[model samples]
Target: MSLFLALVLLLPSSLCHRTKAQWHTCDSGFSISATAMARNITHCRKLQTLGAELGINNYSTTPNSSTSIDVVFSALPPTPQGWIAWGVNPGRHPQMVGTRALIAFNQPSGMPVVNTYNVTADTRRGCKLEPSTIEVGVANKAANYSDETGRLTMAARLTLPPEYNVSKLNHVWQVGPRVVGTVPLAHAKTLHNFDSKETMDLESGVGHSQRHHDIGLREAHGILSVIGWGTLLPIGVIVSRYFRGSPIDTKNKWFYAHVGIQILAFSLGVAAWGIGLSLMERSGQYRAFMGHRIVGILIFCLATLQVMALWLKPKMLDKYRKYWNIYHHFVGYSLIVLIIVNIFKGYAILKPAPRWKWAYIGILIGLSCVALGLEISIWFVFLKPDDKKAQTNASDPSKTSNPN
Candidate 1:
């Protein structure tokens, strides 16, 4: 590879967490603390430091930064979005692909997620309007949407066409069944100051711009995180070897370290996959996409192979050397790529939430570099050297002789 290319390969493409100003965090004190931005960061740091050393507690940046947060293009915009009056959504938008934002909660210090999204407009769900006694309720069929709390948290807004009022406003709101959590676009809607109205004088259909759903967002996040972690960590280490002088050879400590870490990383990845599955079953209403299901099966199979390889490694050392190498190579590399693709997929499916898509770019690119490095090093150490040594041995058998 060219020097410039090699240099670029080594650099962290994005998501370096290098920018202190990436997020616009402020105190709302809604009696909710995602990270308790309450304690002075200095105190957090001190406690965080001790926690880090002992590997006990975790340090968060907010409701103070304990978790990594992301949103879609709109959600991550400079302005603020509207309120959900419900739980949080993980998906950016159903039609979109890619993470618009991302947030990592849970500090190394064992801090709990401080994010307190409004569970209901009534928090505990005590408020509700009596059925159809209201004229508009019967006319628009809005009564069917009320939950135990009487608030229809599952709703999406349709904006007025630019021509009619030309306001670019979502004055018309569409309410649905009892939505357990908040949709990602709620952030966008709030930031845009989306206003709701019972109906417009000229009623119409659900436009893509105007239509909304109680998107199962929280579950989407778990799906994205698992794929994201799997992608960047594995591929980044493997792909980094494209660099001109990286110490990526198997004989080199870097290679073994990379492999060991990846193996452990994949193992941890299982936990992430489980979290995603749980979130799906909980919030996604058990609706799963083909991609997610297939990816899951692949991960399971790959893991099984990894475990078997570890156990039968010595026994099959000679007979199945080629098969073993092939299994590891294909599964490892494939998993890395699969993870990146899956993350992007989650973003597309989770509409409304925007931050995740953007943050994912940085993460995907940066981690790819790391994975590439590790992957290249393996080839540089084994594939290239092995071929050359075989040729040398054939050319001069004398060099292959061992008197001992």
Candidate 2:
């Protein structure tokens, strides 16, 4: 029994140590031996979204030549039964459709197999992905899965088509959960899965993620819109409402402040609107954001009218001054409401980090608190005395009597 206990303890430790060593080896670098005619890999890149690595050995006569290359892709599957894939899209856009891929998975008999697939739009619709010839010439294909490290590595030598450029190659990589027989089941529709494509320069190993670039633009647009329409516009309204007639109106400085703030806010809003248009053109996701785009256009038109109304202001003693005031107040308040609603809509569309959404919520709450306090103070300071004077006058019969 003592011997048995010792053996059990040693067995777990040995297995753990071996597993750790294997993981380190796999994560550190690709160790598959190069082909007999292969040159040393000049470039290797860690993909941004998926936890995958790619190593490339370019055999082109020139940097821009469309020659052959050897590539190795390594990644850990989402599950032990899952599969891994790496591919190139010859199209101008880097996406899953129209990709030539090499997919690797293990069979029930524990044998690793790699197959070429020509991914079409139908493949995205859950069609069975079968082994087929691709546009590019493929040879020297091999794949292996390491049980200890849980890593799948696929190596291939590809001959490029005449039109292919070695400097700008669109590549994609993915990991799936399971395979039904030889066919890979659908991968989870997560953000990481959608963001598994990028453009790479095989010669220099430089990669640029299109998703990251788009995200950066979106963040800029969100920030500008929040500051201009959501935050500053409300503050301008508050200043015009409360400070214009208050004791702080020396030299009518409140008017200038309101004007300056509104103009600045409008400028930023216009910039944000322009950026939104650019993003729509680039992404072509207009239908998804139709409501948002319409609301944004409405806000822009109303804001432009408000700015123009500044120049068309009536004189203080003009007969139509009250009508102008009514229009201004109505439009201003309506804009505030629409701005808040559209900001929330943008938050839903962007789906940025949680902290950003919460931060905007906190800003709105703080602004509401300030507005509520000011409203109560205004009622007490201005409206209460007038009400009390009218009551006093009504109580006194002499003061209430009209001069006939």
Candidate 3:
């Protein structure tokens, strides 16, 4: 009986009550840990270099034959209505292929559950889960409330399939309303795709810092482009056309106004272009919005040609002056049309704050109304026959007729 009891004790406790997965505490946050299943994961990555501030609280990996990851968020639950999530991407953007995320949210009953997603490159319903996909169990779930920060911390585990390779992991994070469910992009308040600071061989952890430099750059570019190219340029055109015949200060008042506005607009446009290039560099997404780039470059080139024409302008008495006018008007009008189109394209591509798009559209509508009013006035001021001549010609048919 004694021998049998000793043998029974020697048997692993796993055979009786299942042992919990091995977990080791981490020092990065208030309280964090990695399970034995997680530490065996040899691959680890760090925070994104840009737009990192708006993303995950913490991200780590565990890799061997199968892959596992630990994601933590400090601003998730107890916030009342939103959810937080983290995922791995094949590339540095959330829209990239083979992108998958693990999300956490509190149910209406206040019980929290972890979910997974497959994301696509879209503005709405960008993250999706397969209809038949099952909800896999998560290893450990922990949460904490920090009185110092007045923030709640939540962490969860994800076990990936055998085909998952942690070495190629590109981390992504998002926070959105609880209504999003498996499709976080559909309702995400903020989303980011970032590069880890750690090298593949280093096996080190990285912490994220919030930065809005890229977002600021984007806003500056949009403002400059819309005001300088979209709004001011059209106004300059209208002033040159309508004010040329104005009775007040008719000595090239239109010319001076046109030149001043054009110069200001050109300067702003150049600055906007520079900011746009910088934004593209920071994002490393040069190839994504090819249409916007092409249109923008065309507008810049045509505008530059117009500026040069001002210097090389033909004199009014020159035989080629008519041809010059035609070329100038065609190029100028084309630039305006293209600018309007590209502004809309930018709205669709950037998917910016509602105010940005609405404000731009409002300006565009106002400009269109101004142009229409000027066009109608032009018929009476310039195109219509003189009333005195019309009456004299009506009284004398022979004078009205052209004699051979």
Candidate 4:
């Protein structure tokens, strides 16, 4: 029992180690000191560790001068044959603007090679690498295998681009397993335009990294949409259909119940729709989820029209009342169907599709079964009995005889 417990305790630590192996976080820092040496290790040691002890130097404020900046990137465990890169950009994420990267990698022969590249833009294929515009020099580079520390200190003298702003200085760093080929086994982070030289940490994760989009906000939007429009819309339909004229439906009780539920749902759904619009604006990827976006718009439009119809509601005796009822019913049902379909489309677009998708599916299945049961009951009580009486009268002459 003691041995079994020990193994179980070690399981989580072992898994964590394996996970960390895929990507090691780089220690980084940024500074703006004119006196800081570009080649000395003491300067980097004095700079604070942003996350895991990475250091960077400030770009020279004096324009047209021969002044330069130093960037020091360190990997915790000496990546004997791995790679590390630091990039500078004018905007937040590296993808936003052209980035110049200073990359240092240990070759298979155990020698360090430093190179430079200009990443103009991120494409559907991958990063578009171009000839760098800045001059790069490796002032100090070393790998101590025994100490498990790999350090690269580089100096770059750049002519500030037209779009570059000193207050909005953005930087990105990455650590990869190899210098060539697809660098998928990596961790990356971007420090958006910071006004001060105070050390700041960036996020790191396994696998390729994209912009720091607000994923949590997007998830909140999804949850709100699924509950308000997806689930509650169907519930409103069921209440209006199955509960009408039942013993509990006193006076306009069914009408009030149905309208209240729908109104509440629409209010929540409108909020969700607004959130969706905000998310789209923030994501900068309007065309990616076209189907989901189109369907969502249609649902909102149809729902809005349905809500407006309540204001123009006609009495039972009006000539156009039947037409109005038909229009309202058709649009409302269509909106519900679109809401459900678009929710699944949303799930498809979500990163690492969450468990809430299954939960919504289960709710949909339950509602559908309840609707089927109601339809059967209504047919048996109202339509089937009338059809049977008509058939009997037509078939038997005695049944049709007049008592008078």
Which tens-of-lDDT digit does each residue in 1-404 have in candidate 4? 34633443344334323222121322243221221323332233332112223443444545543434445554332355566555666555434235566666655566555566665435223553433545433344343221233443334334445455444445555555544532323332212111102212322212222222334445556766877798877888898888898657789788888888888788768777887898677555555567788988988888988778778889889999999988888887888879888888878776334567788888989999999998898767788778999999999988897978
Per-candidate clashes come to 100, 0, 4, 7
lDDT of 2 by residue, 287-367 (tens): 547888899999999999999987798999999999999999999999999998999999887777799889989999998
* Tens-digit per-residue lDDT, 286-351, candidate 1: 334667657765765666665466566645458878777776767666766676676666555544
Sorted by TM-score (best first), the order is 2, 4, 3, 1
User: What's the lDDT for residue 13 in model 3?
Assistant: 27
Q: Please give the range of 10 consecutive residues that has the lowest summed lDDT in model 4.
A: 190-199
Query: What are the TM-scores, per candidate, against the unseen true structure?
Result: 0.37, 0.66, 0.55, 0.58
The residue ranges of model 2 lying beyond 4 angstroms of the native Cα positions read 1-44, 56-70, 74-85, 91-98, 102-132, 139-157, 174-196, 208-216, 250-253, 283-295, 311-331, 344-355, 390-404
- The 10 consecutive residues of candidate 3 with the worst lDDT sum are 194-203
Question: What's the C-alpha lDDT at position 39 in model 2?
Answer: 36
TM-score result, candidate 1: 0.37
